[model samples]
Target: MTVRELLTEMKDTSEVIIDLAYASLMYNSSTMAEKVRGLEDDMDDLKFATRYKVLLSSRTREDARQLSGILEVASAADRISDAASDIVSLLRFPPEKRPFITEMLSEADEKIRMIKISSDSSMVGNTIGRLQIEASTGCKIIAIKNRRGWTYDPEDEMKLRANDVIIVRGTDDGADLLVEYAAGRKEWEFEEIVPDDVIEDEAEEDLQNEEELSEEIRGEGDEE
Candidate 1:
């Protein structure tokens, strides 16, 4: 497979490993722990494959420079898998001393969700960075699962394909927007969601302006 495909698989795999690890801690299940450990082996294999591909693909200095980005992104995926292993290590701690990491994640304003890319998705050929999903919808892609495998936090050059499953973190609204957009059901548009405070401020300003306009009309009528 191509380098992008390998990276894509690596990224998706890493996300699964981390999430499985997280779930293990959540339920305190040895079964999930075993799954995480098994996935780590897959992650290791992908990492090596990615590294070999990068080296094989590069020729010139410029080529190496471009390839470096792939290595960095792959390394990042490996680090996440390693981190999952570290998190699983927490099981060794006494139940009383275990960290509530998943609890804290649940409290965040945004949540992670998986979205499937439609066959006709406009995002199919676009790289994650090029699609500008995060900037457009305020949703950040954390992982993607394609035919080759799962990849964690794909790089800028990781071109998307049809039927890819992407994991993203964002508010509910943002996640919905991304899901629709990726499915080609909606086009990209910036819809700013004003905060309650901003909405209140705008309403107050409008009321003041309306009052001033009314007074101005009354004054004009008197002058007339």
Candidate 2:
């Protein structure tokens, strides 16, 4: 890949890592946290690949200077992903006991969600941009997984296919709405005045209680 393409890919993966990591924290999912770590490893490989390619291509002092700037930008993206991973690392602690951290999470306005396109779904054969997910449901598609593997920051014309897993970040209500639409359940779509389930843990009932307590301590009501 060219340096510009690599840089764009770096930015795309960077967003996915951080967003998914923070989502892991909010849901207390070790599985998701580990996934972010795996993605971080992928990012490291991309970094090395970009550097190696650039080293071979740098032929002049001016080229070296610009390449250095590109490397710096890529490093900054890596750092942001690292910071998000650090946040996920703290999820090993119980949320109830970490009242401060839980409080912070409770206040998060954005959330991560994933939806799989069904074979019969209207979204199956359209481009992401054509779907207008952000414009329609206020959700941003960050990554797409298919036979081609994960495509981060796909262009407007990038085709959506059956069984493509789309990762998105947006408000809880918006994400829910989008999930239904993406899954060919448009009839089930509705405005979520209060999200039905905010926590993704298997022991959701207990976690909900803990979250309620955390909110009470923070002088907030239970999540609907």
Candidate 3:
């Protein structure tokens, strides 16, 4: 990959790894902690690749001066990944000792939660767009893990299945409501939703039709 691509990957990896690390703490899941560690390794590899590319491309004083900034940014992203790794280290301690941490997270304005979809859930066999998940429950899904693997910032068309695990971020109330749907404790109920892109397209079409009608009326008046 090019240096620019490597840096971009590093930045994205750093952000997502940090979120997942905190989520591991919130859910007390060793599985999530392991995922963080795997990403930390990827971050290390990205840092090395970025440094190598930057150094190989620098052939003069001017080149070095211009490329130094890239190295600095890469180092900063590396530090962020390191910090995320440290956060997951809290998992090594006993769960009883971490109640205070969970308490603090609960009091925050927004929280991260992991929900497992049950077989009997009404959410089964539905796409995220069809269910209008965020619109209906106010929670945004950040990632999903299933038999296929982990998907970050999952698309609206991604379908839900039984035993799928989703990570969501939102207010506590929203998370609670979504949890009920995932656990099959409450049925999902909401009015049908039209996607924002579809609404925008329809509005643009209407505007174009009005303009065409105005042009036709002006042409008739000129002929008369």
Candidate 4:
């Protein structure tokens, strides 16, 4: 991968690792901890690859000066991954010894939660951009999992489907609202409201269609 692509991957990977690492500790899941460890390995590999690319690209004094910043960013991302790995290391202790983890997470300003979309949800057919999920719910989607695989930092144009599992970060109230929408228990309301005239027009159209259907049925009865 090019340096830009590698850096993007590293950023996404590091962010995911941090969230997953804390989630692992909060939920007491060894599986999540193991995933963090694997990602840490990947981060290391990315760091090395990035350095190799940067070194090859730096051909002069000016090139070296410009390229140094990229290395700094890569090192920062690597340190973030390392910190995440450290967070998950608490999993090595016995459950009883680390009971405070969940409590600490609960008290945090932002909480990460995984929500599954229901088949009947209004969100099933909408793209993230159309939904304006963050604007309405105040929760930002971090990752999504469908049958195909996981998408981290999903794009605005990404469409939601039934049974897609989304990981989001937000306040408790925001999470609850998003959960309700995802479960089909609540309808989505956007900042842009349809004009009353437009709604009335639609209602009039439906009435006209119903009347036309009735007239057709009556004419058929007369023929009989």
For all predicted structures, in order, the TM-scores are 0.48, 0.60, 0.69, 0.71
- Sliding window of 10 residues with minimal summed lDDT for model 3: 101-110
Instruction: Point out the higher-scoring one by TM-score: 1 or 4.
Output: 4
Please write out the lDDT profile of model 3 over residues 186-220, one tens digit for every residue. Answer: 99995666799999999999999999999999989
The lDDT values for all models are: 0.78, 0.77, 0.89, 0.89
In model 2, the worst 10-residue window by lDDT is 187-196
Q: Across residues 6-52, which tens digit of lDDT does each residue of candidate 1 receive?
A: 89988888866776676566656566577677778877888888889
Model 3, residue pairs in steric clash: none
Give the total clashing residue pairs for model 2.
Answer: 0
> How high is the lDDT of residue 103 in model 2?
69
Model with the higher lDDT, candidate 1 or 2: 1
Task: Flag the better candidate by TM-score, 1 or 3.
Answer: 3
lDDT of 1 at 178: 82
Ranking by TM-score: 4, 3, 2, 1
CA deviation > 4 Å runs, candidate 3: 118-123, 126-158, 173-224
Candidate 1's C-alpha runs over 4 A off are 99-224
